[model samples]
Target chain A: MSGRSERVRGKLSYAEAIREALDIAMDRDERVVLMGEDIGVYGGAFQVTGDLFGKYGPERVIDTPISELGGAGVAIGAAMTGLRPVFEFQFSDFAALAMEQIVNQAAKLRYMLGGAVSVPVVMRFPAGSGTGAAAQHSQSIEAWLGHVPGLKVVQPSTPEDAKGLLLSAIEDPDPVMIFEHKLLYKTKGHVPRGHYETPIGEAALRRIGHSLTIVATSIMARKSLSAAEELARQGIHADVIDLRSIRPIDRETVLASVRKTGRLMCVYEGVKTLGIGAEISAMVAESDAFDFLEAPIVRLGGAECPIPYNPELEKSVVPQEPDILEAARNLVQGRI
Target chain B: MPVEVIMPKVDMDMASGKILAWHVSAGDEVSKGDPLFDIETDKAAMEVESPGDGILRFPVDEGAVVQIGRPVGWIYADGEVASDPPGGIPSSKDEFRQSVPGEATADGSRNNISSGPDNISGKFRASPLARSLARADGFEIATIVGTGPRGRIEAKDVRNYQARRESEADTSDALAVSESASGTGTPIILLHGFASDAKSWTRLESNLGQRPLVRMELPGHGRSQILKAVGFPDLAATVRQTFDGLNLDKAHLIGHSLGGALLLDLANARPDLVASLTLIAPAGLGPEINGELLAGILRATRSESLGPWLKKLVADESLVTESYVQAAMRDRMEQSTRAAQEAMADALFPDGVQAFDLRAALARVEVPTRILWGKQDRMIQWNHALRAPGRVAIHLLDGIGHMPQIEAPEEVARIIEANL
Candidate 1:
């Protein structure tokens, strides 16, 4: 394990890293099974779970009905019986159909049961839009799940993180929801091909800077980093944190970084109103971190309107790197 | 030798037990079955007996949560005899000396910290001050190595280096902007997208704030002269004449979407007028445009019709306001605006496929180009934005979609500001 950590090599896409993580986890634990729609024979819509069915066989790599609710129920049931189950939603948008099973049941089961049973379930969902999937298939709704009390929500931006966080989620005794961005699936990053874990409820500092701390999740993390690069050209260093897990949020990591930077900008694909940004902003406000903030916590997100079909209008709705960079500039300059 | 003591699992649901009380401190000798400490679980508080007859070393303080089957305190057995039963407690030093491989080290080094650098990539670390300063100054730490403690770089180093470079460049930029202001150069013109008007450029316009600026709503978009029937070429012609009407041969053209596509067409048709082209995730590149979003833009007669569709463009839906949707529908209601949207949607994206492939057209242009795209662009993939002319530079902004110029106007302005 130590040898693998020291052996840094070429770049790998986010998809490859996730696959490697799944492969290692399955190999290490026989009880770890992956079940979802088209996950077995189809290898998933985005191909994030490519070719797992053949290796793990039908029992471990079970494919359920077209029902998102049914699949979630099955996973939850399996978890209650001592098996570790990883459920996948064809699209995160479909999670709305399974809200009762997820928010009401999977999330509250362990806590409400007086800790008698542990829900070691990991549900993976493809979230966000960029492929012209439009309103039905697009949308970033992780904030909704994060709002649930007992659920642990995670969004891994990088391949290595996808692998580490997935392993961690599998090991956790409580239910964990993993929101994977559609655009990031094909993106590659180097990943260790062994059992590893990134502790849940911790944020990873992707890029270090002081002018402003850009707290982002899932695909937004990549955008924040890109904006950080652009900001660097302008002589503004933006510290970026990938809040991998939304619920059980690593408040310590976010607050510590914000305390140093004195400025905070929360970026995400979700709408600004009642979105993840609001929660983060409130978290900062409620903590001592608020005193350290030099500027108001700025949130860069999708326009509060329906995503337009016109290519031009669609581009205008969501938060972009240029938007992030510009927001950072304004915050650093006290413009906002 | 050090002996291990673990919090007993008092109940089945009890995952972690807390240390309620400690009877002895470090260096204290202990015998088998000695009452070491009191543990508290979700059920109740119970006394825990020592595992070995040795010096006690309680690492965790009272009120620390410990997992079952995991050692919480250590004891030195010295050379004792085996007497305690398996379920009773510890017996002798040899009996307690059984080492569990891969268990946490006795030094408490592996607690809470990361297990190891398993899949983490690259050595991207810097001091908190250095990171903040670097971000503030827009410096990329990956390009520089640290010299501080543990090879971590400090913010002062970044500031010193940045100050030197900015001073050298500030002199030249000031002189150029001043020269342009003195009538040596023409004003910059910014074009807004459909349903959006000149106000979209307010952020960037204010930033370039210095140069004389002219912003117009395209025939079907803002307050510009509305058109009856508009297409890409028609919009391009109007934009070209708009520059002509302003009495300027060529000014910097910064456009978003329809504006961007129009600018590209104009730059291709008359390369001499355009000093540079800044395209914000412009269309006319890919054939895989989202038809549903386009249909929503055209059929949206009211906010109810347009709200959900508009929200699809961004990951966040709050940006979609009833007023914003109403304004979009109102713009589309205009006879000319409706025709223009229909014609452009058909001409640019015909039957769910992009009709125009401007890569070849852009290849013939010689103007310096800068392309900006949102990674989350739902209408046209950022991949299409990369099809600029050979010399054109591309910046893919994540979390944005087709109309980053509006969703992130300030960002569009900053990128343009940097280019200027």
Candidate 2:
């Protein structure tokens, strides 16, 4: 095969890619619709909706009042009727307000109806802290929804993944949660043009290494990558697997890396206890990877407290590059 | 001719066998039916006789656990020279080839070499500065090919591999171009399918008769550039350039599975470069494909790992030799091979369904085309043969499966010669 280096094309901001996905799904299928607070007229809290209000008009891109629960209920109801509705949450923490509609109705309805009805609803939560939106505005609540059986939880780390995952989330048979890290909005990366699904339940191997495997999600996945770079500086090579889909979590890829590295490090901005890391840690501990472990599995998650209003404290409360580097070093060295 | 003495399938369900002992050394002479090696299967320990009279060649040392159908050694008969098997498998220098798997020395483990800031010994042959920089960045120092004195992985090689800086070399030559086809006989371009290389066309090589062919290893397959992130069009363009690189304006194109679709696109993209087209159970004509086979070959580290998948390639499971399986596995271990293969597979057959429907393209092509398919093909349906244009020829062999070249090489080679 001719080995010409792959040419990078079509750079897009994370926000632009999400909006592009919305535009693509709507243009391709008449049944696809967008509904959120100010998403139609004001262009959303984060403006991820873009100018869809003017393009697709009011009926297709409906603007709703500030009622996450009510709007979520309507979206779930619309999904039951086979109209693909992508409901937007102003922030992920707001998902707590719509737990009844999202978890109980949208998620369980497919099985609850014995496969007679499907709720193909996609919910986008502008998640994670970086804009100093404090606890309410900047929470990554994927874990809360990930714990539920029927709902698919995901956190797209780049612009490319954001667009592809959003489109796939729209076509899902059940509710798929898209937790877009707030800070990643303006970050630019090459996004493939056209409709393509970055298949859910598959972890993206960001980089390869042999010393350890760092399982990271959302913003933490990027931070862990930088941290992995630092680890490589001292000759510590690590395999960084971006847990794009938290639910149906790709256990095969995780186990495979752990089998090679003999060390595991879970990196996420969620709370340390009962977060995604705990599940991943338990997955390895429960699997054959436990016997091959050179060091105890390490989870560099958020502290056991709500994210603070103070920016410095907020940064300290969650895992960062330095924290990931330190933890990876310790794990690789068997210092744990 | 050197004959590979494989780990015989002692039982109907035998998975693997361990070597009890080898009576001969690397260059020792042996004869047919002689006591060659002692093997221990789950059933019992038995002596394996020589398959041919030749000098014994051990691919691995004693005490190695080999898959049920693995070629542990070879026998080069008198009056015949021993060469690498017909398949284009690169010679392996795997540490395990000299010892048993899981045999770790006190110095360090062969399977898992420690890297990062924690362990960069001088014996590793990496520059201290490059090692330090790589550790600080967490980039793979081993993945970077060294260009310094004695092939030391200098700071620049690591930088280049990372694409941190661009230079004269294309991404592997822009990143360029695999094994030289015998001689400049006739530059016939042969493209293999996913998880396959130029070597898959081995059986046809002898019978092709004086036609110089460039048996191209598909990216991620053999000694070609591993474009881990290339798309179908880019791949087609690369093949088109292969014609130019060989200074051939046009040549006969033969592709299998994914390669079949690729050649079609090349003919569509640049018909002048492709004189004639021969597709073997090609993809893009239908959506059906074997998901398990793709997954099996991609994940297999050894021949055993490819057992079930290799068997699905043909109607007769017995044709799936240990040497063939090892050859497939060998090409798989090519550099950036895993990433390249995975990317191509995901693009071409996402969710086990062939992504593109080339039927429309087939109807457009004016080139002389022949679609060869095995009626019993379990990978891609032979019914896809019906999609061929009226002008295009079709041959559906009754007994073969996905691989028509390996099963009916004589017929296939004759078809190529006729097309030429």
Candidate 3:
């Protein structure tokens, strides 16, 4: 962990970084095991598992049948006993299939059993819309699980956070859900080698500004950062906060930025009505930060519909860089 | 930190008081217990003593109604700079710049501070943060111009307005002129007195027909910049500069009170600029003057207290209307303007006595001269007209006060035309 923080380990794609984290975790802990459909020999759907199955063999990197419910149940049972199972869901939309096991069993067993049992299961869901995955394949369901008290939900926007947060999720004694945006798989960033855990329940301030504060999650964070850059060129600056963990949301980070900027705009891929933006807006209104607001709180979230198969419609459903730019400009310029 | 001067609760159940007058001008040195200002409650008027010994600086102009315990001014130490009282409520000092919800402009005209679509609801649309800032800073929401949708006032608007006021306070010697002229030939320039502006000649101007009329707004009045001068001559020079800018070879000059003094000086110094001279209850003529009435005029911030003082300008109270009171209130909108006028007042009427003797200037001017004084004028003694040169025609009208041009505009106009 110390070496990773000190050394420059070159650039790596987000998918490669997550694979490197799985490789390092399995090597470091004997109890660590990987479970998912076609993950072992088929290199998984996105090729994130890649050649890890050849190196770790069938026992450590086990591939399950195409049953999300059964796969998630087995992963939870293994975590409850001794093995630290890392379950992979082909698409986050499939989490709806295993909600009974994930939300009721894996999330509440530790609390209901009076802390006598622990479910140290790490579930990785390829989330978000962008690649024409249609309604069934692409969805951002982090807020759903984030509402569950016993589970830890996180979304990593960069390669470094993707690797570090994965390592941390596996180490957590409670069940942790990782919502990794599929669009970010090919995006490359400097991912330091070796072990590093990005602590859960913390946010990343991507940009510091005085004009307005922007709270974004997952892929929206990346888009907001780019939007902030463009806004800077137009003489409007913004504070972009990447809420990495939604379950134990970093209230202080969001509140402090709102207080300084006197304006707030939340960008998310979840449905616009009751998504992460609603929670953030409520938190600000309920806190003293509400009084510091110079303008009304704005939300730039997904449209009120499922992800479409048409690429143009899919892009329109969620907040893009241009959407972020316009909203931020309106917010800072007092036009909102 | 400077010692704050707050409105004291003189009587039980008194929530607020109207400032009657300030005994000490801004930057004046005083010791503790010295008379600072006079405030009148519903029951009685009383003098408020100084709280500390230092240079005095009043934030609120005279004639303003202040709530009890609210700061009226500050007493800074000898070398201390006059910053506003920390966390204290700002009132008249920021009146011109800070938009208060539902506040009428200086001209008694409302400017629709909130031009938002919800204006019909009579509610100001400001973000929670902006509302918080305005509340903390003691700003009125309705007065702030919103830049957001539906004319919603945003946080930046409040901050920017505050910044503008702070910068305006630091500026000096910048003139704000309002000029209007009709008819042809040489312009007949009208100069108003203290606490008066170009608008004061409205009645007189209408009576002076078929000639160009140029109304020169006095410094610290109307839109004119706050004058920064030490002596009467310096004040005259500033007006002279404005006069020279007109590029007129010669013009008929009509002056009232302080304006009369300035015109007399101008006529003596530059005879070529004076075609004829008319002085109306002019100052710089005698020692005896109504000090209380002048102080009342300077101190009044509210129309209630100001109306009575202004009624003293004419023998009949009917001449002072609600609109006229409000128009006078506009001249006191800015605290700096009040301070500038107060400084000039102190120099001219140190103890309610005229300081300058314009008899020599009046005698030296070769232009035709005439003096109009109301027999019932309470501000200045009409008997001062006796000191004018034998060549200068003097008219003392009955049932008139200091403002002969306003009370007897037709008669004053006829006298001016006859002199011309």
CAPRI-style class, candidate 3: incorrect
* DockQ for all models: 0.01, 0.01, 0.20
After superposition, the stretches of candidate 3 with alpha carbons farther than 4 Å from their true spots are A1-9, B1-122, B138-147, B156-420
lDDT of 2: 0.76
Docking tier of model 2: it is incorrect
Q: For residues B260-365, what per-residue lDDT tens digits would candidate 1 score against the true structure?
A: 8777887887788778888887777767778878887777654566778888776456777767665555555443355556655665567878666677767887
Chain B superposition TM-score per model: 0.52, 0.61, 0.62
Give the alpha carbon lDDT tens digit for every residue of B105-177 in model 3.
Answer: 3332312233211222245567786787788889787666554554456666677566545636744333344
Give the alpha carbon lDDT tens digit for every residue of A1-336 in model 3. Answer: 366546656699999999999999999998999999889999998999998899999998999998999999999999999999999999999999999999999999999999999999999999988888799998888999999999999999999999999999999999999999999999999987789999999999999988789999998999999999988655567999999999899999999998899888999998876779989999998999988877667888887777889998898778889988987887665544
Q: Which stretch of 10 consecutive residues in model 2 chain B shows the poorest summed lDDT? A: B110-119
* Candidate 3 chain A lowest-lDDT run of ten: A1-10
**How many clashes in candidate 3?**
17
lDDT of 2 by residue, B1-420 (tens): 357676776643345678888888878888899898898877789998988888875446677776544457777767566564322221222211211112213331211221211111222345554676677778766655444332345554466455523422433322233434465543566788887777778798777777667677666566565553466766777776665566676677888988898888877877776678889889889888888778877777556667778898899889997776655665564324676677778877788888778888898888889999999898888998897878989988989899989998998888777877
Q: Which candidate tops TM-score?
A: 3
The digit string of per-residue lDDT tens for model 1 on A111-218 reads 889989878999998888777888878888888888888898999998888889999999998899998898998888777656889888889998998778999988
* TM-score per candidate, chains pooled: 0.45, 0.45, 0.53
For lDDT, candidate 1 versus 3, the one ahead is: 3
Top lDDT model: 3
